[model samples]
Target chain A: MFRAGEVDALIHLGVMHDPRARPAEIYSWNITGTTKLLEYCQAYRVPKVVLLSSANVYGPRPDNPQFLTEDAPLLAAQRFPQMRDLVEIDHLVSTFLWRAQGVETVILRPVHIVGPVHNAPSNYLRIPRPPVLLGFDPMVQLIHYQDTADAIVAALAPGRRGIYNIVGPGEVPLSAVLRELGREPVQIPHPVARPILSLAFRLGISSFPVAELDFIRYVCMVDGRRAGAELGFRPRFGLRETIHAVDEPA
Target chain B: MHTAGVGLLDRLHKLRGQVPDDDIAGRTQALVVRGNEFAMRVARWLYRNYFRASAFGIEHVPATGRVLFVANHAGQLPFDALVICAACFLEPPTPRLVRSMVEYFVPTVPFASYLFARWGQITGTPENCRRLLAAEEAVLVFPEGARGISKSFARRYQLGEFGTGFMRLALEMRAPIVPIAVIGAEEQAPAVNIKPLARLLGAPSFPVVPYPPFVPLVPLPVKYRLYFGEPMTMTGDPDDDDDVLDEKARIVKSRIQSMIHVGLREREHVFW
Candidate 1:
């Protein structure tokens, strides 16, 4: 597959991003399928590789700082199995980079990437009456989808290989973001929010899984400094610009 | 009377100037959190008319430097914190926005969380504290946590066991610890007993104030006197033994307690 186009670097932007996908289906595409692809890359001897990971790997823990570094432990997967697979996939890729004979790998973990196609947070925010956990105004960082592509391209530029958090310059409170979107949130107690979200998803009303709702409940921000300095990748859209992209109508 | 009204409004416009205008700055993070301007204005009004708050030893708060204000948390909610911040912002000897280290459970609520973030309130995490200190910003901490605020009416004036994290953080960040004693806050909405009803709401505490029994959340009118002590410096490994950390915490606790005693002695009346 790799020798066909004289491809010097292979970037894996394909991952089961939507948590609403059935567990088995998501595992097949994100976990097992990703492995099969990486194995092929090794067999085909692809010189360089880059994997798109989510900053959600950090998890929405009470202790998580507003800005997190790449070194932070990947705990998001523990809370939501959906995230668990991404961390597992990251673990696999990281291990491969160290042991693989010739592949130079880079992992990019970006916060909510907004664009024409709706992502988790964007999809959640679009609900006419979005449900927010009572109390948490966890700040949300946005990166333009194009910016993510730019980061992947920057990683393809060669040099160092490892993990980099591709993030934007500023963050707006999740509450303010909702206000900016002109959406009224139904405040639900945290304990009840999970079950309600689960039921809503079961009814096919919710676009994403219940576990991903933690993003709206706690702070899980990532520091994008390394991406800018090491990969020469910077986000083009400012805070309001990226948010407005999500607010765009269908 | 018309001239007096205009003068007051003009003075208020000047007070609004102290609140960082984040829109023009294009900065996010803390600066972007201009807080609820209306809420702040109300807080300002209360800082003057309600509490009639006054500050002493303001010079101790450095003109520009990373500082941690370790104050007694009381008055059911955080009246002490509001009045202290108000005292700092309103008076100009050392005017600086003081970021309050909010309890971990604080951000779990809706509008309140939004207001706190707008007011530059960060979760009481060591990482957040370190970042603020590194940036040379002032942070207000209630090391007593719920223990101090939830204390029964009898123990209102007493400083509870201080959390060792602040001391360890102070040691780690090398940020000077400024002990603060907020008088009269203990008298406002004094919680006689804190019921475990917070579990129902998934909240941290649900203190039971004796007055107005139905509305325990409302605080009574009380005068405030905020005393800022000399900057206390510490030296030692932040990762020192538990006993060492506890001992360090005790020194600051004692300092605040002594200051509180003086504040209590000086205040002629609670409703002054």
Candidate 2:
């Protein structure tokens, strides 16, 4: 209500992703905060809105396609309560997008975003000699922190409106990224690592939730074809460059 | 008979120094599996002398570029994928490797996971498959997934539910789908009994077998026959209707099933 005439575009990137926080707190903050923001946008006639969504919404499933698109089911919330808040926010924003006449909404789902500030999946990407499951080497899809900033900037440009999967260039094995960082892979047997990681988390030794370990065990890649086609946004860094720039294990 | 094991190491020694493009992990992982020389050689030997595997339609496989080989998963483990990989390498005009899509739980095994990556296996993610295909690498997928490989001995050769992801990927990537039927592998480690402990064992199927407890769990030498049918041309968007996806998958399944019938009629014996 305050910036009625001044603000024409709104970039919604604020999220409370701390797993330690109470789910109820996270929900109200995201949901209610977003509603107020949308209310302001509506009151102020902010025509363009861009949201930074996550590829994690596509949950890790044995049957998940190698790369997910924007149309893929947001199944992560079904399993991880931690993800429910993001999905709810997205559902609300999307529902708002269509119901309102003048507002054009763009939702972008990006893969593991790594850089100065570490997200959930990025935290796993940095630690030296992280625990790797014995027989699995899942593909790692990442966007540089700078490139993510660039994507958000691109999303706010005038005429783009729709859901898009924003992925970085190139694909490599997670083992490759670990090696590039000079970290030794601590191999853990799959059947056993599940509980051990959970216990480690419970013991306050590890920050990553054990549930998200499935990403490392399986594929969590997303196709960025739509973004490339529509937004005209291409990641400046390739897989090698992003990995080298993001995590310096040494 | 002399072992080809040592002999294969000799070949890998010559192909060494492919490290220029590899990242730190790819290089380190190669050290673990020795560029996957030993396992590949063993699989090659198994496909050649052990299984006496013969191929019928490798010509359908493109000498270059991305092509999807949809095969039935059997033999309890991925012995079927191994034999298929062997066929691609051993009897080929172009000695390109076929990257078989593996399960997420595969990395649970420490040593084997390294070998899988070194040997050119990628996790079965559409994005992974799509990338490999875009790079023009040959990718193989078992649409039946763990279900087919773990099927009961009595239901052997019965194709399980065909996952439609491969079909959509085929359409999306615009790669031709080659339906392949592998015979004899179903009997390699036949599912004599699917143990109730499959869940406890954390495997798709824990089959009670005929082998004694102390006996080495080597897959019995079964004469193998592989049939590669014509590649089907895919049309439509990858984001097509679920029914369309199901029908597309069924079309490929029926084709493979028919090929299995042909292979069954032609296979001289399960074991020579």
Best by DockQ: 1
In model 2, the fraction of reference contacts reproduced equals 0.46
For residues B35-114, could you state the per-residue lDDT of candidate 2 as single tens digits? 57777778888988898888888888888888999999887778889989888766655455789999766654555654
Best by the TM-score measure: 1
TM-scores computed on chain B for all candidates? 0.86, 0.88
Looking at model 2, residue B115 earns an lDDT score of 59
Candidate 1 per-residue lDDT, tens place, B149-219, comes to 76777887888888799999899999999999999888887666535577776666677755556445677
Write the residue-wise lDDT of candidate 2 on A153-226 in tens digits. 88888777888888886667787778777889998878788899889888989887778878777666788999
Q: Candidate 2: deviation at residue A87, Å? A: 1.7
The estimated TM-scores of all candidates read 0.86, 0.78
Task: Specify the poorest-scoring 10-residue window by lDDT in model 1 chain B.
Answer: B1-10
Whole-model lDDT for model 2 versus the true structure? 0.79
Tell me, per candidate, how large a share of the native contacts it keeps. 0.50, 0.46
Q: Give candidate 2's TM-score.
A: 0.78
